[model samples]
Target: MYIDSHVHTSFSGDSDTPPEKQIEQAISLGMPVLYITDHQDFDCPPGVPEFTFETEPYFRKLRELKEQFRDRIELRIGVELGLQTNIPTDLTAYASGHPFDFIIGSTHVCCGMDPYYPEFYENRPEEEAYRSYFEYELENIKAYDCFDVAGHLDYVVRYGPNKNTFYSYEKYKELFDEILKTLIAKGKGIECNTAGFKAGLNHPHPTEEILKRYRELGGEILTLGSDAHQTVHLAYHFSAIGDLLKSCGFRYYTVFKDRKPEFLPL
Candidate 1:
């Protein structure tokens, strides 16, 4: 099984799963290493549960758990920072200051709204909204070089009105290519998120074509993640995700330790 590189626990605003429970589940699945990547979305819109957490206790707990489970499984501390261009918070400082093994810079919000909510799609063509999302993603990484990998490269599709029914890499080839090239130029990676399957899409977050394009662009830092909020969702569809990566020309997937990429054979 591929190392589960993305996960969540009570430290995240949306997840309530205890950290220990997630670790136990990983052990039960015989996963040798698991990265606990809880969410930290600064500048969330009003009237929503802000996706921020207390870092002191968050690190304290994870450090303790890392030691407690060292023999059974390796636990890496990670954070999924929601990237935005206009937010006032110093994301670079926060990301660089943390003792993170992996950092996933993701775009959960576009134009000051999260697509997960229906209103993000209201009155806008699904294609337009999707383009805006990618535009923001490109802007974010270019403005901030603090993350190890871009989490869920095509996450906007998961909440699109058609939900990948009409989505294709060719439809937005220019933007996708720019995004891939920018990531490769910056030495950043992207995650193959399996949550798309759970979200009713036929493929993973980035889809097979995008993965192949990233490979073609000479981008090698790729990680596989379930984006799991609960134990049951951990390592979802490992066999299929692994096969898809190999088919897309990947013989290895990645894990992070001390924020450095380590490729493991697929």
Candidate 2:
């Protein structure tokens, strides 16, 4: 079975991709399963559109789409939550009450600022900034338990000074192992986000070494997501994901229905 577990449509503040267009594209690409994971970063930094969404409206729209395309495709509702030390209690409470099929808890902002800008790394050492990101990530996962999977474990590397070229899994091995152990103890998993390839990286997020390490630690719940924000990115690079997962020691990838995982053969 073919599916994309991470995608954002118009509902996400940063994306212009409409839900209908994503569905049409997925259908054309032979992917019958789709997850609409719009962003919701409560209390995000200024200078950008807020990541919050009107939940009622979002659910209503997805319900309509599910019914409209019921025969041709299977649709799932999900959200990409920007995890932080202080969990948004109101939003998390509301999310718990909803019928979302999946949740991808991710870290975008590190130490009160996004690492996307040069200023975030201006004077700070690269290793220091990257370490803070992981520390915050581990803290958030330990403090919050609402999500099914942790997304883009080494996302900060994507915006580093020299980018992934100067980065290595060995440098962050201890912290990464801690994060993996916590997730495994909590029964959570990580997504193999393919967005890095589209960003000109030679490999996917978290690196192949990280994936193999997760498997070696007895972790099993792994999901594949394109982390697509537009129609053209839907299932991007999915054609080779099977072999990639096999090489990483994963025989199955995961999907969720009603917030429960179902393993699909790689």
TM-score of each: 0.98, 0.97
The CA lDDT at 163 in model 2 is: 81
Clashes of 1: 0
Candidate 1 residue lDDT tens string, 129-210: 9999999889998998999999998998998888899999999999999999999999999999999988889799899999
Clash totals, every prediction: 0, 0
Which prediction has the highest lDDT against the true structure? Answer: 1
> Stretches of candidate 2 above 4 Å error?
87-91
The top-ranked prediction according to TM-score is 1
Candidate 2, residues 52-119: lDDT per residue as tens digits?
A: 79889999999999999999999999999888776445546755988899999999887778877777
